[model samples]
Target: MLNAKWKKMLVGSTVGAMLVVGAAGAAFAADAASPAKSEKHAAKHQAKLEQKAAAQGLTVQQLLDRQAARKAALEEKAKAAGLTMEQYKAQRQAEHQAKLEQAAAAKGLTVEQLKAQHKERHDKVVEQAKAAGLTVQQWKDRKKAEHEAKLEAKAQKKGITVEQLKAQLAAKKAAK
Candidate 1:
């Protein structure tokens, strides 16, 4: 009965999602198809998708399907390991980050160079956030609390132990 309720909700929600996505796509296409579409918008859209496909060595559809499959597999693995979705995501992110570092080594770039680049981006975000009336550290702390609150709600809904959820959240926070 519980499973059926979830399946029903999922199926019903997907139809609404598809309609929203389809409407957005149609609007974008109509705007782009206009004779007056700025060259900048058209070129940006064209080049962005083409460049992404080339970088991933995949056709656009293939890339999308592969990403969806990877997400599904990750979710399945996380369930099997008794982890919440966010915990598994963080673990995969760390693994992929390590792989990127190894790839950078092959290109003769040092870890220090990567760290410098990361710091530059982080500093830019910090400046932007400060300009928007919040310090970067304050923004980050707020986001972290909101995320934890969301996970706590999910844990409660799933009848998970609060202590276990707290421990998991602590581990995740420490990892950051």
Candidate 2:
């Protein structure tokens, strides 16, 4: 009876330790996978923010400060332009509409009609993807692959990456 009880206790303790070790291994593997994913995500987000800052010719903090200051400056800019804020907004919208109208006319459609067509096409694509068991990200990945292929083909033709092509163009413009 004493030997049986000792054997039982040993078995129970071994099983418990194995369970804890198994759980720890699984948790470690999960943690390992996520840091790589999160690091990639963080890198992409940082690149995007940097691009936005560069486009504005400002540092990231300055870009944020500029956006914060824009609210107070909007009225001043509009006033300087000899229009009230509402008038300025309407004028800007009219200019945008005119550009859109010109673009739509080139494609043989009115702007409103063209937008409806675009909405219908977008909806159809979404519905078809759902029917085909594709998530939005899957569709986006396919589109990205297609775009990258085109870019690669173009780069091959030009014998350069897109960045190299842009640099060549800039050099040409500067020479001119």
TM-score quality measure for candidate 1: 0.30
Whole-model lDDT values for every prediction: 0.81, 0.83
- Over 1-176, each residue of candidate 2 has an lDDT whose tens digit, in order, gives 56988999999999999999999999999999999999999999889888778644568888778777896698888999999989988998999999989989988998998889879987887776677667544666777899878877888898898778767868999998
Q: What is the C-alpha RMSD of each candidate to the true structure, in Å?
A: 25.9, 20.3
Tens-digit per-residue lDDT, 1-176, candidate 1: 56988999999999999999999999998987775666768788768877677654567777678879998998899999899899988988899889878976976787778778779998887776667666565667777898888888988987897678888879999998
lDDT score, candidate 2: 0.83
After superposition of all CA atoms, the RMSD between model 2 and the true structure is 20.3
